[model samples]
Target chain A: MENTQPATAGRQDPTALPIGILAIAGMTVFAAVFLMAESEAAVGGLLAFAAVAVLGAGKLGLLERVRAAFRDHELTMHTAIVIGALAIAWVFREDHFALLMLTMAMLYLTACLGLNVQLGYTGILNFAGSSFLGVGCYTAAVLTQHTAIPPLVILPLGGLMATIVGSVLILPVLRTRGHYAAVVTIAFAVLFKTFLEVNDSLGGPQGLAVGEMTLFGWGFNSNIEIGDFYASFYMNYFLLALVITILAFALTRRIERSWVGLNMDAVRIDELAASCFGINLARWKITAFMLGNFMIGTAGALLGMILGFIAPTNFTFADSLILLSIVLLGGMGSVWGIALASAIIVMLPEKLQLIQEYRFLLFAALVILVLRFRPNGLLPRADRIYFPGWRPR
Target chain B: MSEAILDCKGVTRRFGGLVALDTLDLQMPRGAILGLIGPNGSGKTTFFNVLTGIYGFSDGAAAFDGRDITAYSSQEVYRAGIARTFQRSRMCLPLSVFDNIMVGNHKRLDHGLWANVFARKKLRKAFEESYEEAHELVKIFDPPLAERMFEPVAGFPMIDRRRIEICRALISHPKLLLLDEPSAGMTHEETRQLMDDILEVRDRIKDLSIIIIEHEMGVIERITDRCIVLNFGRKIAEGTYQDVANDREVQEAYLGAE
Candidate 1:
């Protein structure tokens, strides 16, 4: 007799929806408190409390239960998360600095997600993430300055330009593996910075001033006033960043769940086996590299417009390391983990001004600790499950 | 044979003047199991590697399904309807059982990024079909394993992992399947069970020809319709398993010359 029972049989919990909703709400509240905290002492206290809470939840096995709940109500949980993000924006509408930091985090989230495709999914070692981002930034800067192109078209154009440049780098990357591949990207990072510094048409070391992003007739830099309600102009960029981040997240998730992700993972895990099984290693590697570069480049273009400036110093090798650390600290191959890690990496330094100068050192120390203790990452990716309700018995 | 599914002529592979495989000629009829047996360092595995395009043939010609696949890359060789397992049991261990099997299903999958992301109904249908196919293959090998399709291959025992590897090769629906030392690290009882599974798979799938590199004489005697023996990269004997077992050169190669 054929076993025809659905794999998810008897695993459904009725409380999943409420638990998922509560989890999202709790996370939103925590973000609000973390963002609004004015004193260093308050920020430190909140961090310590969060650490204790997370530890306690793990001890009580609440983490697994909550994850299961979220898995059961995936669509509902996604909707809740989007609503929570919008709520955070509304809460900080009048606070320009807070809104700016939040927007920056969203943009960084997009870029980190892009990096995750290379480092996490396909195991392509890329130490020059910021170099790719710089390509996008400069592309946006030059196009906005010289041509009459709209910012919307320029955004993806920046990504396309980055993809073209990354295609050339991939030749050397494909010829090598492991540490050698990593060195190739590192060399590219240095070469890109030096190129920007030497080239006078690209504003040299001083960089170029980017114009404001105007959609239709509305300028992204203009403050908004609705009768009695008022908000900073950064709100416009914040919303745009949110949409882009959501799209990137969805795209990354789709890739992870499909045959494309399976082929990439096969190539990542064992190239010889993948090839013997009919997987085109170079083709998939190039696909991942170009796709990741496109996302990173797109994020960079929007970031250039938001900041209204592009400089070689803004895209130094150290900046690339920061992005790499975020991918590492988040745990390679875990998209949600990358998002959480990026939030902490982006916001904590800004909140604690005392550690701003030594932020790189702090990130280095954090990554080392995570590698030694929780090697898989803060929230390691779970096993890939193709069917929604499927579970191991 | 007039209906040979795999034909290799003058296959030669050398590394820095050391011949790993000498000028070899091999042919297998359709739906026949050909056992490749040799002592350690006798170039049995090397023959498999060369055939699968892992190590390029120094000089040779191999035709599979009547198409010249001598110069094909590994990926192209697979697309040419040739699939293989590794001597050391190569698998993406972190991947699930279903995923390991689906890796071989690339020939059937729609690989377009746009289709994967936006074609929801089509992707879902493909996923369902793949899941059913993988589940059935695993069930054919081991019924209990089919239930744990989502479990990672890392946790499975060696015998089960070997079964999964064979399943991975079979999932591709190739006309020719290559099995490299499927009994490398298994007990006698496990080896017996695996051979039974292999025979069962051959019976279940029609027109499926297998080339297995095995060190176990009992397995070769039972499952193979024909046997080829190698000694120091040279073809020492060829015939039925019993005929090769009685050959003087085969005995001298396995034991020592008096």
Candidate 2:
């Protein structure tokens, strides 16, 4: 199904909780953590958030409009960043907490976007997404850490590297098809893990540690002061993550509604019939796989930046399955579904800390129940999400 | 006389060692209804599959509108003005009845991602024109169906599903329409109305040609400009209704057969 923004009044239904409220709540919590924290960097983070929060809430009527404008996943899923930022403000408004949360949120958003491309639009049960993300992480990590190039150049290069590697893995396997396709992709992820553990040039099992990512003149290693907090290179790098995430989000959304998206849906609906429509089945299938993997690579880069470390164990098939579960629980064929699924998958374990290892089991069971009850997703997409152009009824 | 619109020469096809078609040659003149009749296991369906490129032929080449298309895919063949209905009713189940027909208009979509999003200038223009055309076709073909355009096609019963299938295929305004067992599960009156609709389609596109496959003699006699009979990949008879019906060989073939 395609998205057609319902009328304004319909969107602003009084019964439904406004999306902005969540954003505001997230900010308030971040502010408390930021202002009262002991770290000098924490104070600056708090001020940055306070400034952003004031702007966000100052125009209450506009904020309401913004809430109404929440179309898809950007609503609930992006809320994690707001919440995380607010939390950072609450505990330690110093250092790069606000920046870190934003960057982390951006990376998560990119991952969600990537997963949506595979699971939402294409109907592919890709369980190798995280492995590709690892590819990006490793690529960016090695280039920026080992070489002299700026991270700006390395990030896109990292995405390209992962895309090339992922395409080589995914394109040829498309002919194998169905549950078999997923199995092969998962096998590829495991293979990547094996390669990482054995290979020496990529730092072997311990993986590569990131080096400094100095921008043109901005020495990321330098520290700055804003209000009561101190800022460092980590904070700037985190902001960089937000930049990449926004770009990824826009691009993914565009492709989701484009001809590629529609044709991909056609593939999901019926391969034989779609083939009869002059659509090249092989090319589109490969392209979708590659594009999805490209975003995963970006996510991987962000993940690498956040931790400044990488290892073979990080890119396991389990991570891929977790991502798949997120997409499934959120919705198949929905951008928002991917976002919501990511937020839940990332946040739920923290909230249900007592469940410990059983959290995954609980999620798995919940996914099954959701599938049984709402076969489509939490927000089922429009089935005939057709472009009412060029073709007569 | 209308010019021959479809030509097949030395179109040979085989299933392993089994011959599905043996040097089969046929010509369908423009604006004519061609009937294909055969017993079970005959090559009628095989020929349809071959012409539509569902299965590659074992040998030979073909041309349509002065272009060789024997090597093209089914979709390519469709783009070159060929449309067909499935014997089992292959209408898109999830799409709306109208949307199924809109598929026929796929060749017409011009906008990429951005244009499709906002229905930008060129795409919006195309959308408006196409929607109008789909609406007009629905009104002319089945007035009642025109109103039910937004309903899911899967829910339609046997008759309406077939009708929607025909509507979808015809929406492309093909030069050649291939209907495989259009009346397979229909009542007599339903079959009659379907035939009438087929005639209306022919009239609407005067240059259009239809190669219809059927076992029913009544339908063959009523709609065909000429008929071809096959038995086990071999052509047994080719003639008009009276000519083929009166043939002694034809009488023998149909003896005690419905």
Candidate 3:
């Protein structure tokens, strides 16, 4: 054991270990400070610490190595950041803004991953993504309010309901191509919103109150404390969101490397070629639409349950655009990129509330800039080989 | 003569006022290379599209291996042992060569969503086998290409893309392979090499029939066992390559002789 430890330690860069630990410590401290501080000052302190770290690392000549590691293990770094932020929040009991934004980011990530399956992998234009999210939210809300079903049961059921709606829409939606299909989705979103507003049984324009969700008799609406770390309702929701997010991420990554993902890609690149290869075009299209909506619906249900309310305004065409922008800005089909994009979309406005009114304009400009420079996204998907000996030596 | 594998009877396709394929009847015996020659608008591609079920035929029927497939969808036709290459190569450029080829074998894959997620051990085994199969097919088809199986299609030359398309079609183990202008953009030497490869592939794969659409008369004459000529969306002549070339109607269709 002693000999093996020395040999393994020799293989890993000695500096990498300490630097990683230091970086984690620094990030944790900075996050704790940011969570406890006022919004405007928190952003400043966070940026200052980040700048200092970058500059210090550069001065120490460790920046290049750090950058290389970050580049190679970008997902690991992002995951670490998320875990650190949540851990800080949980320990400190900072449930007001940090936990809220973190929960929002997770929900957004789930929704964007759903969109990524359609627009990124399947090449389907779905402007009705928000409508699916709304479907999920409303399903959960209506069920919790009217029925005696548990939240756990209603969550998957919400996804099923959204899938049904998405599948039914696919017939007309798939008939159109490219921009035309996008138009169809946009119209569908509008139709869905109007329908929600008009239906009195669905609470019409006023919306409905969602009952507190319980899982195995443990109410998520209430707070529980661990030995050292206390959990608020937001923290409970945050932990639940985190669990769901990780599962969704794992599932998505698996699908991306599987035949199912390959077929979706084939369908996206060339429908004619995909069909010629014996890929069921309609089935795949329907699958992409329905599965994507399923994820979105799940997120929607979770969001509604956590918020304890639902309204037609929550699922708007504007919200759909924002979700799509998250996918695009994150580098279409890139999981980590989408997560980063969602984080920015969810947290940036709150951090820079001084320019809250101009947040959309800033986001638009940032998107335009990113498109101009990195049109493929912040992290365009690289060629992943399925078989051995396919990589360049 | 071998058994007729692909039979099209009065298969007609109309695009509103214009007929793309007019009462087209074609039959291909197993282990035969039949060349389809035509003018620009003579519907050589249209016939391929119709048989492959890309475009719905307005009339008549198409059968593969004695089974009626006129109403079959494109993917259904493929599952029924028919695969085709496009005139303009349709490659998934962003995808790895291995994935592009593996996608051709998708019909045989275990693609249950829940199964893929939950059944890791079985799925991994299936994936490894599929990957190995793709590699083996590429190695047998083009030994040199076996090394570059992971490279994206975007970096590949047009000829390489064409070869990869052929390899993809072959991986599916289709009984009838359709080559729609496979030599459209190739030089004479390249076309000759492609012809040799096609002939070699035919020799290797037993009972495989090919219907090649070509504008190059040399390709038609050298590669095809028999030639069918089309003009104005109708068959003008059908015979041996030499016979079709010498036919007055075929000559007029190409040269516009008075």
Candidate 4:
């Protein structure tokens, strides 16, 4: 009676939809909204229109029909879709729009992964993620202005500083249970922001400027050339971000499959049981908190480097809410799902600039709809990777 | 007396005005099976909690293998070679069967974050070894369950869940294993099979003492070398199962006022 339902739920099917067509369709709609709209408000409205159309298509199972069309070529379709999106983004010189949207997409992707490790995998709901982001930004800002070190040295230092602060702050907070932990972290966020605002040495409320980064006199602020075409500074920054994003993704994916991840999963499921099994609860909880903050701090440093400016206002409760929304809307514990969700949430509202005024309302409606219908997000995590070809049977 | 692997001296636990485990005292030698039977609210679970450091005692001390463990935390107590199972199943339902058992091997597993990220091959090798061991143990306990090692525990039957809980405890390689009604929801045959498996486990693991709480006299009579009967947070009788069953105080405690 027990071994019936494949033992695990929420696994995403490889042949779910013709993803290449979906990506092309999604990006084409995005590009079209950017091109034809006279005003930002019109773009926002058009983007909203496109989102609704997709939702309607999903409900009607039109996506399913398209999925069935490419069932035989799933792998090829997926690869083609990815290459197509990259090619389009490369060709389009929508400098301000493409660069900012793409950079922030990767930024949010990093932050969401951090939150996923804490809240999703370890079941520690930390509302103080933005505080760690601020810590990282400030660390970089302070170090770059005061020290002779390159951005490479300063960046990881920022993460280390955030880890130190986050580890100390979470100790007292982790003593509490689920909702209490949330409240404690929320208080910590408020305290961090307030400290930054009141302290005159840290530039008071006007904020600080982070110097342009260089690696051994190779200025990141300057544009680089490849073959014939000269890449923009933002594009260079985007490439740098892409490298970091891949590293972060690979590291987190590895951790997810490791024994430490399994231990955290145990603690998340049942704290008492995990304890009885000889798992140190505080140790694992702290590992999740500190490591999560470290990644988040790196994302913050990236944000600071790209903007070349820092402010207390940049890392706020609203930013924390958005970060949390990325985790929730993405689906907990699904890394790639979070990356996709981050891109959609960050880029969609900006591209559809028509509804900028009603952006929150639109986002709220979107989140509610996602939770209502696809509670597990667009891509749920797969259970195990089966390579049946190599099996003895 | 000093050979006792687990020793409790005047252990007391109070929740407000109510004393849950009142000045309880017990001792067990290595490789011995001690059955603790009491009516509901007689502090059987409370004593277990105090011993495992889940609940702090109001007074008195508990020692495990000559070390004072009264103030130790649950994890500390476990690392000191103690493990327990809940009266109700506490399986991590979403995790795979291999993972659930592997969790019990966490203490022995390579747990350093850097090791997990950088030294993955070594960690994976260690994990594979543990997984194989867990698989072997599962095969010995229940062969059918070993086949579903990769499946999630959510769909396992009640009996299998119970078996996995015991297996989880055993994987820790504890000196003292605390079983809280392992046969709570099982049929008569299932209970007998569980008892046999418990004895088999005791036979396999060297010097592996067990403290089991059971309501069924037959289980206590058949499995326990000695029994302690509790009533109203106080032990009223202690001896062999027949001796405790024949005692007037133990009889009155179970049957109630007449």
Instruction: Provide the overall lDDT of each model, using Cα atoms, as 2-decimal numbers.
Output: 0.89, 0.71, 0.81, 0.78
**Share of reference contacts kept by candidate 3:** 0.80
Q: Candidate 3 on B1-258: residue-level lDDT in tens?
A: 137898888988999999888998888888889999989999999998888888998998977898999999888898998888889988899887878888778778888888776777787788777767777777655687776776788888777788888888888789999999998788888878777887888788898899999988888888889988889888889989999999999888888889
DockQ of 2: 0.32
By TM-score, the better pick of 2 and 4 is 4
lDDT tens digits, residue span A266-354, model 2: 67767776666656677667767777787888778757866788888888987787778777777876665665566456644543445
Reference-based TM-score of each model: 0.97, 0.79, 0.87, 0.87
Judged by DockQ relative to the true structure, which candidate is superior, 1 or 4? 1
In angstroms, the error of model 3 at B57 is 2.6
Off by over 4 Å in 2: A1-106, A211-225, A228-249, A384-393, B96-99, B111-121, B144-152, B158-160, B215-218, B246-258
Interface RMSD of each: 1.6, 4.0, 4.8, 2.7
lDDT of 2 at A188: 88
Candidate 1 displacement at residue A161 in angstroms: 1.3
TM-score of chain A of each: 0.96, 0.75, 0.84, 0.82
Task: Please rank every candidate by TM-score, starting with the best.
Answer: 1, 3, 4, 2
Ten contiguous residues minimizing lDDT sum, candidate 2 chain B: B111-120
Query: For candidate 1, lDDT tens digit of each residue in B121-162?
Result: 799889888888888888888899888887789999998999
lDDT of 1 by residue, A155-175 (tens): 899899999999988889899
lDDT of 4: 0.78
Supply candidate 2's per-residue lDDT for B109: 71
Winner on lDDT between 2 and 3 is: 3
lDDT assessment of candidate 3: 0.81
